[model samples]
Target chain A: MKYHILIAFFLLLTNLNKGFAGGGEGHGQAFDPAGTAIHHISDGNVYTILDGIGVTLPLPVIVYVPEKGWDMFSSGHFHPGHHEDGHHAYNGFVLHHGSIYRVTDPTFPAEGSVEVQGFEHELENNGGKDKDVYYVNFNGTKYRLDARSTLDGGVLGGGITSFYDFSITKNVVSMILVSLFLLWLFISAANAYKKNPNKAPKGIQNVIEPMVLFIRDEVAVPFIGKKYPIFLPFLLSVFFFILGLNLWGQIPFLGSVNVTGSLSVTMVLAVLVFIIVNVNGNKHYWGHIFWMPGVPGPIKILLAFVEVMGLFIKPLTLMLRLAGNISAGHIAILSFIGLIFIFGKSGESLGGSVVGSVVSVPLTMFMMAIEVIVAFVQAFVFTILTASFIGAATEEHHHDHEHEHGHGHA
Target chain B: MTGTLAALGAGLAVIGAGLGIGMVGGKAMEAIARQPEASGDIRSGMIIMAAFIEGAALIAILLSILMA
Candidate 1:
């Protein structure tokens, strides 16, 4: 368990290394407000076209925007069923090619705020000028921005502010909680070990003991070989770090929170795995990747090129897969909650609301519960795969006696 | 209109998959319980088989989502 805490210390060191090496830039800047991390500018404006199908459609455009706040105005984000009695409800936006869009800020008719043209938000919405932008209040700081999307009709929303209340809108608060929890966890584990180094690990150790041992014996030992001890620290760190974040992300508001979903965070994890895998890869492993064992010389050369590309592609796939799976789940659950309005606005007569409202309850509940398993499974898959990659890179694949002596660790 | 039914179907499919995985795991444990020494070998098979089941179910859910 103390080992898990040491991973936190490594996290601190890497962060400090990042701070000293080149300040926060690019992928290193997920939590950084200055960069395009969680904060995204969305294109695709929302429009409430009353003609077709009696439903307002949210249209999205794939383009780039200077600020993340501008995504609120994209048509792809239109909430067609957002209406509620006399309250300000949504009436536009549709799913086109798996993305949402709508007229950005169609209801914010404030005199000083921005306005929209026939199909765009420009100076016309703000008095008489075009390009009048709106500000999103974070904590208390206001972020200004414009909408951007992709060429294939997808709004790219980015830019996130942590000013909202610590428990509500602040990711920093959640991170601090994680850091403090990690500190407490480590200290407790260390104290336990200090009192009795080999007493079967009591208390929290009881739960974590099996898992830590599992990673080393199950994941690290076979793939990493004798150097498993050296890499054990990093592997254990990643498992717990991700597991902790995963569990935390499941904690109600905190669970709904997007920590690991941030590209910056995923990028950092991928880079760490990349560094460790490359730094520790043995000779025969690199040889196999670059030079096949039994193939034509020309084919071997081609395979070598592909193998080299595999290095980056492998980690990239891992990062995207993890981030996409988690984020899509979060968005889907929230979208379900947004469905009640759709039925109401579509004039479905209040009857459907009962089923929609009642059914979503269990659905969302089930989703929340499943997310727990997903959290653990994803973390395990990542840790296991990382170890596998390292094992593959450093060791040659054994076909003849692979399973005859599979249980026997290398 | 049918999205509701599709969601319910998605839930059922995942639940079925989850149950299938549980059966595979439970059986593995039972076999291990019967033969403690073969736990390692049985466990490996269990994990691989479990992964296949999970992959199948996950695909089903994905298809369900796309269809829905």
Candidate 2:
């Protein structure tokens, strides 16, 4: 059974290699490891499962133009070609690298599908800063493409643009899929417990019960005290939600969706935790933040400022830690695989390719092993920090005298 | 020039984080050795401290990337 499983694992690895190879089908252009790594980590509208097999799952594209009104269509209308570049544009919106961009020039058709010649990216100086400007070619004329509007107000080089993309992206799909899977697993396990109340845990129950108990015993109870039961559900949801997404991204042939690696997703999760913790904050938490009971008047003001900053920084760190770690892991794995193309001189040398594969396969495997551990560690860390924050916020004031005495002794 | 500096900054941040996490792990090991029964608590505490240090380093790295 072990041998069979190992053989299946090798087969999956080979399939992964084929998928990557298909995406990197640049004829003579130099292999761009950094760009490739970034592209792989970025969320996409079209989900390409096995690029070698040309199997892409289309997602719905919903965009809103300020004056042009709402336009909805399947991303398949883009006829995504190599590198997820669209062969055709639907209603003036072209898909480039799996992202939809609108052609601003009036010369391009506004209502119907049109065949696009190609896409071009140029570095243009915008207000003393160099920025990538994308253009789509149609009827031999290159029209500048406006990216989807971002709420960053151009601070991140994305501002109020021609359109707003409210599409079901790859990350969104992955989150839905993972959530549904978790729901099924948990519901079935719950049923098992209900049906066999006297018997020992089995199958999925065995897998989940230990983790639930660990969090309840080690994290929730110790940190949150008697109020653990109230927050246990939220903590479990956060832990399992993150763990499921992290593991989902680790799968070899499942589009390698980097759901947890995305900053926006992590930001939302952090925002949820922030809201929950603040809303649940007792009088002691608010008092400590606004005016500490024991500190000097001058120091109380200084400390309040620091404490308020700490409140924001806690959630900010939570967001960055999860996204940074997951993204770094994905980038490391991709860079290792890029070693093959680097050594092969973009497939010009057979011996170089062989050596590169020999070196990178083991390295990639080791990195994947580390990533599995990271998947658990990061989820655990996020949960523990969240619990600690909650514990601090909801802590009773009965121990105030004890804490003061301890500080006096120190 | 900016790219080079960004790389240097990121490397420096990693170095600091490496040293910090190394110390946390080392001390945790010593604590575990002294009290084998409390290893679980020690290990978890070590991880939390290491994560805090890593968070600071990650912020630095992110700033460097944005600057680049």
Candidate 3:
């Protein structure tokens, strides 16, 4: 049993290496550290099951162009020179590096041409903005095919620049799964309670009840005080959902679809907190933010501006922190795996790969173990802060405490 | 040269985070030793403060990535 476990772990590590390496040519024989690491963490148009084996699940590609009106097709249509389809293009729109773009050039060089590479340099020079390399906005401008699409090292002479993309990405699918899983788990737990009238909580109730209570008592009650019950459900759902997704990302096969690591997911979560805090804020909350009772008129105005800024900054920090940690963790693991290939290629010897694997694999495993603890801790921290923010907003300031403390000064 | 600079930036962010967390941990331990009864409250407060420091460091790291 122990040997089986060990072998399974080694296979998991090897498969991960292969999966990342297969994204580019040369299969698992070569590795591009930054490219591989980022590719693994970032969302993809096609769900890759086994890259080395050439088994991929293509997602639906939906695009809306002003001239073309609407172009909807399977992402498989974007595959380069397939035996079955011949060419992957719909209404002159080509999918490149997970983005759809129009191609006017009939004889564009294959993706990765020297001309395309030169265009990329020019594009970067023209705009210093942090462009999404995978999801480029089509603005009816002529792009050297290489600049237009990462896949086809060719050049796009000219194409439509503006198009609305509403395709269901891998992250979106993972989010749907997460939502359904939470609904199923919570509903069943609730049903158990309803069926049996509180006779020493059994099964799912036993597992979930304590966590619910912990959020209520440790997180909610201490921060929120009397109105703890009002926000308990929100706090519980946020905590469990974050925790579930974090843990889900650690599962061997499903490691790629880390929904929490995505910036959009974290931003949405932060937006919910921002909306709830502002919408549910009592008069006292607004009073403190806009006009402090004890402060002078001039100082009050300055403080109010700072307070208003804090409202936006608080949620921004929340979004960045979760996305950063989760994505960084995944990147770190992939980079460690990439180290093995780096050593192997550098010295042109098997000894380096062997030595590197011996060091990197164990370290990667240790990091993965830490990630499990991080999963729970991040969820806990997010929950507690949300509770605290809500608590601060709803809390009625007690002048009585100030009066009592003022006695000491006297 | 750019890679080296980015690595340095990432390293500096980690150092800042480590120092901040270390201070929080050290002080919290001392507080617990001095007043064991209030340790629970001290620990929770320490975690929140540490999280804020972590959030700042994460932003720094992310900005460095974009710059690189």
What are the candidates' interface root-mean-square deviations? 7.3, 4.4, 10.1
Instruction: Give the DockQ (2 decimals) of all models.
Output: 0.10, 0.60, 0.54
TM-score per candidate: 0.54, 0.93, 0.81
Runs of candidate 3 with Cα error greater than 4 angstroms are A1-16, A22-30, A50-54, A79-87, A91-123, A127-161, A346-351, A401-410, B1-10
- Winner of 1 and 2 under TM-score: 2
**TM-score of predicted chain B versus true chain B for each candidate:** 0.84, 0.98, 0.93
lDDT of 2 by residue, A1-410 (tens): 99687656544444444435433323356677887788899998899886556578889999999888898999999999777888999998999888899987888898878898877778897765678888888888879999999987876568998789999999999999999999999999999999999999999999999999999999999878998999999999999999999999999767888899999999999999999899999887888888877878999898788888888888888999999999999999989988877777666665676667778889998999999999999999999989988888887767644445211000
Candidate 2's displacement at residue B62, Å, is: 1.7
lDDT tens digits, residues A1-410, model 1? 99667555433322322211211222222222211112221111232222112233433333322332222333323233321001111222222211232324434332222322212112333232223333333233333323223232311222232111111122333456776887788779878988998677789777777898899888898667876777788888888887787777666522245666654567689898988888877676677677766669999898888888777766775575566557656655555543432433322335544444555556777887888888888788778778866776666445573333221111
Shift of residue A219 alpha carbon in model 2, Å? 0.7
Query: Any runs in candidate 2 off by more than 4 Å, and if so which?
Result: A1-27, A399-410
Score residue A378 of candidate 2 by CA lDDT. 92
* Best by the TM-score measure: 2
Ordered from best to worst DockQ, the candidate numbers read 2, 3, 1
Stretches of candidate 1 off by over 4 Å are A1-144, A147-173, A197-200, A344-354, A396-410, B1-68
**lDDT-sorted candidate list, best first:** 2, 3, 1
- Spell out the clash pairs found in candidate 2: none
